[model samples]
Target chain A: MNPSARQPVRATTSINGMIITVASGKGGTGKTMVAASLALSLAAAYPQQPPLYLDCDVEAPNAHLFLHPTLAEQQEVGLLIPAVDEAKCTHCGKCAEICQYHAIAVLGKKTLVFPQLCHGCGSCTALCPEGAITEVLDRMGIVERGSAAAGIAFARGVLDVGEPMAVPVIRQLKKWALPRPGQVVIRDAPPGTSCPVVETIRGSDYLLLVTEPTPFGLHDLRLAAQVAKELNIPTGVIVNRENGTYPEIDAFCEADHLPILLRIPFERAIAEGVARGKTLVDIHPEYGDRFRQMFLQIYETISHS
Target chain B: MKILLTATSPSIDSNVDPRYGRGAYFIVVDPDTMEWQAHPNPGIGASGGAGSLAAQFASNQQASSVVSGDFGPNAYNALQAAGIAMYLFGSSATVKEAIENFKAGLLESVGAPTGPGHHQH
Candidate 1:
């Protein structure tokens, strides 16, 4: 028997339910690859309670390329933008005064509202003295839900091209695809440690940070790690295309106390397969068991901590 | 008519600020009387929508014309809607020089936005 094939120690207790978010500080660091593989492995391990894969990278959702889920349901997501009623407005400049985004401005007799700049915070509407401000739904994106291989539940949010904010779309996606009890959830978060990434990883039980063993990867990983620390979430690192050339990543991880959960060595065949819309598990069937073992380890670590 | 000039400092002798949205100061002056009042720009440190905020300030100050090196789309639209003329001045010119050029009709009126809308952070 191969030493790598040895079975990993499984947790004695049930996980009940857990949300594992896969994120990266830099783009093209294999976040979707790890997320899809984990979902596939989890679904295979627990066929009775398959995992749900949510692509929260609304601005550039690409998990569907691997899972190819048949999206049978779709819902439009929007933000409520302020609409000023001129008849009731006194031109007192109160609405503009309260808007932090500067989306609304009272220019003399005209009240100008820039819908694209609005964050949908509703502060303007609530602060309008004459009750002239009303909120109207402005469509920004859409959320789609369906199932993939092994009956893995899949959902993804797609933001409209040129949309400024992706937080609203991600928020609506999570609300639309509420996971059931005892069901595992794998969220594919967007790249960068900004508001969109924060919105996706907010309520997760565990965060799996994916990165390559490169200078850019290490730089962004540090920033992403800061966000994880700030959010107080238990995080693990997965190094993709690992060639052992960059020991700095490991050193930083060891110093930061962020456990290195998995390291996927660089391979030409894997890259070619992934380029053709194949998941890591699909290219390497044995990785399915490996992913399951990683999941169990995460559960055990989180439970203990 | 009061001419609003984007300035680097609160004085007319200061160099003209190239950026209209993130201008350091706004010096409103009557070109005929040379009477002026300088106000620190409120939009200089804004995270976003600085152009719109600066435009709103210009309208609130009742400036009939604006002089800057470049005008962003939001500022251009608001100023055009408010019927305030936009004139482009060289960065080398001082606030007083830009205002003088506007009165002499030597400055070019910008028919469209000279720069992109949002600031890249």
Candidate 2:
């Protein structure tokens, strides 16, 4: 199966500035490439207003490769897991019954709490009938902050492997950035329509969905679009590596009334440059103007709508 | 002495189930009177803590020992805490044969859990 295709777009009827999140429902679809390039171009176009670029793909954050930001600030992000007080825990199995994730188990004098399976929703702790369960801080990831090229403020969360959760890290990373008027926050979201994706795109003003021209791309793009529709987030599609061969994506977008924002043609040079950790706009300076124009068009559509 | 055996089928002729918590059936037997009863493993479809729940069921059955192909960490710990001895039964062996072997003192006692519950929900 191809792990590709996903993007999120953003449009605001009330405001011009937006927290545009770029996502692909699947992985390895160049969400990072588009986010880094767009953020850099927007930063270059407006020097007075540096966009806040947040890499919310904490599980396997790769935006740092293209942005090359020297993270100056680092902070640990944690989740509160349930800690049972055996004295009060009468083994009624209430916590286990309430836990939808099966992170807790009460087995006759032995109470087992698997923190890795915990979602940190605090359901077990809050719903405890005996008040035996209490939430405890458990570190799961780290949030780093710095600045990249074109004076763009950068922040990304890195979740420790095998942590089984990324929402907490993404939430903490987003908390670090306080949105200001005229501040365009470009959040780089993780792939898939999972909890992490929902967490990354939550509270965002706009979504910039980056997709490809393959069948896998169209399929995941539809799923991502449905999510945005449900969340009432206005979205636009960016078709990467567009060679004009696949008409399926175009047809789908037209049928759904979704505008095709920017089409970056597939080029070997672009791929080679990205291999060495360079963004498209950075490698080919001419694309900077095109990306800036694309950014303006996004805001224009929002204003018009 | 009463004993609990994990089986793939209700009959003692059925092969022993490799999985402890998610096993298809559990047979409770009183060796002194050869009194036997077959019950479906309730934890078989459990999302998580199937092992723990299965151990709790075994404790409720008041079985002195449990025989299975393998035991997960949680299941093993719960069984140990419940003071129930566990024995490893060969995968190819049937429930009746495993119990007979146990009577002959041929069953190997499980000292600890075989591995983590990677297959658990």
Candidate 3:
């Protein structure tokens, strides 16, 4: 099986707006590469309705480097944190008792709030007995929207340095980059199966998981597959650096009934190209047609299910 | 003067807990009378801001001094704001021994935070 053997297929069926999210449980498994190239391919296949590419890895977003989108709009994302009014305050300790994160602490006459630990649930402000607490906008990150090659619609969220939470930023990016009718949405998710990853893959039509052939990769892939199972989402695997040595990934996928959608072998030229900030389709033009075929197969599976 | 000490258990014979934020027990004692009351630390299993919660608990007990191995930034700041002095004690010392050392001026007074907050990597 030659993955590069191009078989051109006609684009006859309309997708009617489907969200496809590319993710991996382990870091540095080529998630951004696969996602960016797929979006570009889809954009080329349907010039009338370009695909929307969203970079949901707010903590360390790098898809913009590959897409090179000329950002035309930027907006600040924030969360509502609590602010205490000392003048109208009574140190009743109710806010401290109610907080589950321990973000707020009340002592004799002092009320202290730790902004970093806050989840922005607005529980402290709403439950304050003396009406001393008010909600304040705490800036967490920013969202940028632009256009990339082949007129691919691009958007990304960048979280502030040292910020612990990325869910709000990802949520804001999704809202800002909502897809139109008959358009496909491609999301580049962050590595790992944590809250941020779950936030990115939620409400998606299909999940494409990328993994390498290694023990570390296999360990995290199982965890990621569990998350997809719990979410009840249709999922497929893309094995990067396929060196025929690690058959455990194949065994796991076979037992789990997950199809191997694509396999990108370990090649020095491919690594060098990607290292120079080149997409897979840029180095090998044949990949553009292959990705289109992959999308059509995914659409077929989704339509039947 | 009343003093707070981080301990492993509710007894004076228990060894001192090195961690101030996630310590097991907080014992308030008066060296002069040797009278003390032990309270389980409420911040033992807190997900975040454990230091601040522990400092608030210490202030509520009206402790003038806190004896622990290390004080995180949040606990140090909160204790300073409440006019409480911080003292460093050996991790192997018993709660009773720490109290004796505090009276004998053997424990070292901390000028700044002894630890970066646990939330930081």
Candidate 4:
């Protein structure tokens, strides 16, 4: 292992539960494909465990595209927005001055409000000496939870289109799928190493960074690795599309001393299966055995480390 | 005297207990002297508005100043009332470096970091 690359491992009591975060630094790295596939595999491997699938990719949540979960329950995710009572007309600009997100703006005897920027932390409401600032719930997104046909409990957040932030939606989705002992939860994280990605992988037991063998993939893998390191989480790499090219990936891993856990060879069947909205393990039973073995390898690594 | 240098960890590095929208880390430093002390961040991942979470930490420690990467207005105002000083760490710099820069008086007070389209409820 590279001396600088060797991270300090802080061991804690093994909680039979795992929060597997599937992420890629670059876009179009098939993060969702691998995340969804593993969730399905685990559900089949340990049927009694009752694994929950959480899609933390709020910006563009598409795990539902593969999981096809029925809408058993649905609700809006709301944040507290500041409301100004015009009747108590004193445009003192106190609320605007107190707003951190710039959600409130003041002009000559008039104030404008933007509900989207409001974090609902209730600072404006408290700071408003005029008693004009109050809180009103503004819908941010929706959390939908239900069971897929394959017996996986799936929960995902669909942020309202045009919404720039995804953390609120991701947080709500997590609440929907609270982790339970003896049962595992798998999270399909969003692409990129931004705030949304961090939110998704924050509480994970182990992070599985899925990457392809390309320049873009290597760059993103490195970034995601740093993020994992900063969070002090154990990380492993899954090489997707392994057949074509991987010299750069191998070199990077060798230099970083990162463990390469599993590699999925590029196959027409996998591509076709994905295009058809079917899992590779489902289309080819042989791959099912391979994924089962992969799961075993993961379990062994977690057990030892 | 306890001098709390309030900070926020990236949402991903945050943990439970500090129930903020984004994750918050409380650096309980020695007052008048900038010596390192305990970091009260439970290390649970969190996301969303940090006003309540930041308030929880400030209230508990009676913080004097907040050295954060970025803070919304709501969180900033709350910390101010709690007698906590708030500074922005928007750049790719360390908390210590930012503090040093601020003390050297090289930092400009940007007031609050929140702008349109970036605010949360």
Candidate 4 residue lDDT tens string, A1-305: 11332233232122246677888898877788887777777677666665688888877888888889897888898787878887774867667556655456553444556565566788877877778877888887899888885688888888998776688889888876676654567888888888889989898777888999988899999999999999977788889888766688988887876778778888888888888888766776666556656655565565566
Error of 1 at A218 (Å): 0.3
Error of 2 at A288 (Å): 1.9
Give the per-residue lDDT of model 2 (tens digit) for A1-305.
01121122343222235678998886777899999998888777777777889999888888888888989999988888899999988888778777766567776675678676677789888888899998998899899998888788889999997776788888899898655666788999999988899989888767888899999999999999999998888788999889888999999999988888888888899889989998988789988888887777776655554
Tens digit per residue, CA lDDT, model 1, A173-227:
9999988777788999999999999999999989999999999999999999999
Query: Local distance difference test, per candidate?
Result: 0.88, 0.82, 0.89, 0.67
TM-score of each: 0.95, 0.80, 0.92, 0.67
How far residue B86's Cα lies from its native spot in candidate 1, in Å, is 1.5
TM-score of 2: 0.80
Task: List where candidate 2 sits over 4 angstroms from the true fold.
Answer: A1-15, A85-92, A121-133, B1-89, B93-121
- Backbone clash total, candidate 4: 21
Candidate 1 lDDT by residue in tens digits, B21-104:
899999999898999999999988899888888888988988899999889878888788778899989634788878777777
Candidate order, DockQ descending: 1, 3, 2, 4
Candidate 2 is graded, for docking, as acceptable
Q: lDDT tens string, model 3, B6-94? A: 99999988999998999999999988999999999999988788898898898889899999999988888888877889999963379
Q: Distance from true position, residue A150, model 3, in Å?
A: 1.1
Model 4 DockQ reads: 0.02
Candidates 1 onward: DockQ, in order: 0.57, 0.35, 0.50, 0.02
Ranking by lDDT: 3, 1, 2, 4
Off by over 4 Å in 4: A1-15, A300-305, B1-121
| Residue A38's lDDT in candidate 4 | 78
Ranking according to TM-score, highest score first: 1, 3, 2, 4
